[model samples]
Target: MTRTTAADVRRDITARYRARTAKSRARHAEALRYLPGGETRGATRISPYPTYMTAGEGAWLRDVDGNRYLDLLNNYTSLVHGHAPPGIVEQAADQLLRGTALGTVAPPQVSLARQIVERVPGIDMLRFTNSGTEATMMMMRAARAYSGRDIIVKIDGGYHGSHDFVEISVGAEAEAGLEPKARLESRGVPSSVLQSALVAPFNDLERMAALLEAHHERVAGIIVEPMPNTGGMIPPAPGYLAGLRELTDRYGVLLLFDEIVTLRLAPGGFQQIAGVLPDLTALGKIIGGGFPVGAFGGRREIMAQFDPAQHDQALFHSGTFNGNSITMVAGEEALRRLDAAAIARINGLGERLAAGINALFAALGIRAQCLGYGSLQQIQWTDAPVVNLGDARRAAQDTGDLHALLQAELLNRGVYSSNRGMFSVTTPLQESELDLALAALKGALQTLLPYMREVAPRLLR
Candidate 1:
């Protein structure tokens, strides 16, 4: 493939996507009346309206319109074993026959907790929640209660969940009034909450140290995604996580690792890979085996804040659907199946896919790159090294034309990935699936090259 400019690629891809979207617009128009943005999640919405998936199995998903495509997105990397895996389905169905939510103790809950405790080294005791958002919220509450402090620190571009406290500064642009150190991105997130949340650039140990020093006594915790998933899967730099641990300890602040997405990176999640354990760990996604579940656990001394036995405990955490039998059964089975060997195998597939994509970009002379860690990968249309959210924001702006074209062309070619080019490899995906994806990617790139040539001549040069 010949080198092409970004603008020409954008124009060509947009033309094709507009035509395809025209046919789907009627359905989307009807959906918008009931569902905001014609989608269930904020991130899932994209131009041309997102394709509504009907069913999924193994490494493939079929849309409502009968379009079948390889399931590279993997339900945002939650379905590590792939959709409707036999073990997960069977366990869930068995538990469903018994009951859904008893609002009481169930055997499966204990079973799943044990599995998690056994797998994750840092977790001593665990509490269940309905979603990662809820788990992270509970983590913050626990951190505050344990430290008797109000403020929390988060990495820039890190996404813990949709909760107001942690959502600040995520996906915020520099022009959006985001300060280099900290800024609030959402309204109704009380000024108190905003004031309590501090942001530090990822991979910047010195800046983080400065923030910790400034906030010292008032900082309850330092919460971060061990690997930033929201801003295109940027891995933590060497010693970066260890540095955070040291700083948090120095300031007497709790260190919380939000591994909701990164849990799939290893059997013990990024903490194991980074070799730095946190005071608390937030978990979700693959742990639930495609079911809704969230959990937070750490040192028993700190986690006792949630114990009902503690009369004067300052923290309270409870949810009706938490520890629901169906979710517990599914999660238990999922974790049971997700051994170290399985994790390594899935990661191997991701490495292969990433290598192929990077090679394609080099061969085609496109200023694109793949970034991720273990089963998760994101395509960035910039040659710049992305270390922090600021870097991601810059990359997004500089390569907007190329990103628009790449997404449209990939969609048209029947390869579904997140709008930001996030893709995950499931256990069920074989080399053949990888080959198909690579071929589809090649075709899409070839089709958009003419447009790229017209748009950004300097990029191709």
Candidate 2:
């Protein structure tokens, strides 16, 4: 019998994907003419072409090609209750008839803000925004205004949405040392960003204290994700968040939590679980019920700076759709549905999924690990534990082809996930659905055996 060549496996998966997604291919080809890279967002782009999604139901998506997939990506963890739940749809529809954007401080907007302030321990008064980008951007502004400082420290590989100042050191790897340079993530971000932002590795408390000791005078706050979703879902070291709180209080600098993604880890966000509160919190994703929304809130003293009564010193914050009725009502419904019981169920499924993947890799003699916290996990190809962005990057160094193959195979088997190996569990996901996912993962890995053996032999145990 002839061995399965890498070329053979590649052609097989490509042919299968193309055959199953003819309409998707056609739509993508048309999109390429008008949209850059044939898509609106960079994250959803796949190698052959992006899938054209038509509709979504509980934990499932129907593509233009009529294929049904178990959606593990959950629109990058935004669709917490899964796409278009009955209550969210109805609430949004009622508001839609009333008004989408009333150009005033609508009741629904206030109700949503109240819901957030009540839930999050750190948030005393909060304001809404159009996106997580806006929330984080405004959070930084509030921190700076309250503290009267210009410099902000951010964790390497911690993403607080895409704006100019926070663009520093995003997913940036160190060239020669443990710390990555404060490199800007996108172009058009001003060069002055390098001075205002200082980057440090995640899960490194000693390094964080040292940074504060050196630059605490100019630093307004130190912002980080409790568990950086993009940085391989590595949990914070036991006292990492507590240590940060101590450091910030000692240095007279504010502490900020970017719970844009990690908020769903618990009912009140990761801060509640860690028993640490931030002076400011930036939120997005699940809070909006799959709509475009964002919010930031913190201590009364700091947030009071934004009050109109403060006169000249007050930070005038306003947006046309800051508290739009549609998103506000929809978001309220979303949060209401995601109670503690629902969170626990999904988190159990997520842990099971993570464990199943790790067990499968070990059984198959593959050197890989799936590390994560409640309801979230990420696959890193290297055997080493991923504690920070540098560790994650080094683990990913030689597994591009392997990852691409596995993702394609998983798609072919009716599972959809992020190309970056991040998987999120939605409230609608069931134990039975998890069984199908594990089967698909096993099938994908088995299919990729030959390719891994040939191209990434070091990955074999």
Candidate 3:
């Protein structure tokens, strides 16, 4: 008898997907007329044409093809309470009528700023921006002004946001060590970004210290995601964050925590959980209550550089929609509801899902592991510890086929997630949704057995 192959299984899955998502195919074809790659952003693009979503409610999303998914990705971990949350939507609507952008700071904005300063350990004062990208950009500028330095250190493959400076060393070649080679990853970014950047690997204290020891004189700040959300959701190694604090203090360099995605992990972000505070914090995602928003705050002295009272030395910082009423009220509602209890519940669910995923992998006798912290999880096809971005890339290189199969199969069963093996649990998610996801995984694995046995036996025990 003839044996099946992974390619054959993939072809079958693609055909089925194309058949079911006919309307989406037509929609994408129409989209090709105006949008590049039939989508506005790179993250939302999916293989065999992206599924055009029409509506979302709570934890469920409806595609243009009229298919409903459990929404595991949750708009890339932005929606903690899921879509169209009643209270948040109501407040946003009310603010819309009053004024979206009134050109002055509203009481709602002041309330949010005070609320965050009270809750977060590091933030003493803050300013709002339109997106996380803008937040990181301003935070870096503040650090530079505070330290009177030029260079900034970042992690290899750690995604801060899409800007010229951060575009450096992202997706660089994985090499022998954690030090970044400083390869420019994006096209439009100037080569000068490499000069202003120093790169190090996550979870490695000694290497990090070495990088700081050499460049501490010229370094402004070390910007990091407390629990790097896009870098495979890897958690900090024990004492790693505290060690960063110590080193920054030793060198007199500021530390900036990019808590855009990791903020959902705890009440006051991973910093509070780890008991290590940075000089500045970049905030976004869940804080916006599903609106477009970002904020950067730090010690009052550092933040005062933007104050008009600074006279000639003041940095000119202003945005048309900086403290817009709609985003302010919506974000306040989101934060007000996201108490310690809600954080604990969602984090508990994340743990449960991680354990269950690992168990499933073990039962199938596959060399895979689920890695993450709190409410985030990543399916790495390697049993090797994914302590850094290099390891994540290795898994992607070796098991690209496996990753595609898993996502395609899951989507076939009314589940939705990132094409890159990421999963997150939201506050609106139910245990039943998790059960459905697990079942889909089981079926997908079972279906792939024949193909795995034939083509990718290395994945098998």
In order, candidate lDDTs are 0.81, 0.88, 0.86
Write the residue-wise lDDT of candidate 3 on 1-461 in tens digits: 76777778888888888888999999999999999889978888788888888999999999888999988889899999998998999999998988888887789999999889988999999999989999999999999988999898988888988988898776734764645676787888899888889888777778879988999999999998888777488888888999999999998999999999988887888999999989999998888889899999989999999987764698877788887889899999999998999899889888888898899889999888899987898888778788888777766775646776777777888889888889988888888888988888888887777677766677789
What would you estimate as the lDDT of candidate 1? 0.81
* TM-score of every model versus the real structure: 0.93, 0.98, 0.97
Instruction: Name the candidate, 2 or 3, with the larger lDDT value.
Output: 2
- Cand. 2 TM to true fold: 0.98
Error of 3 at 359 (Å): 0.9
Q: Pick the candidate with the highest TM-score.
A: 2
lDDT (tens digit, per residue) of candidate 1 on 392-460: 776676444565456667777777787778889888889988999999999987776676566544445
Q: Ranking under TM-score, best-scoring first? A: 2, 3, 1
- The candidate with the higher lDDT, 1 or 3, is 3
Residue runs of model 2 more than 4 Å from their true location after superposition: 174-177
Q: List the residue pairs that clash in candidate 1.
A: 4-452, 5-452, 5-453, 7-455, 8-451, 8-452, 8-455, 9-451, 9-452
Tens-digit per-residue lDDT, 108-197, candidate 2: 888888888888999999989999999999999999988889888999877787899888877747442556668888889999878888
- Runs off by more than 4 Å, candidate 1: 1-24, 172-179, 454-458
Global fold similarity of model 3 (TM-score): 0.97
Quick one: best lDDT, which candidate?
Answer: 2
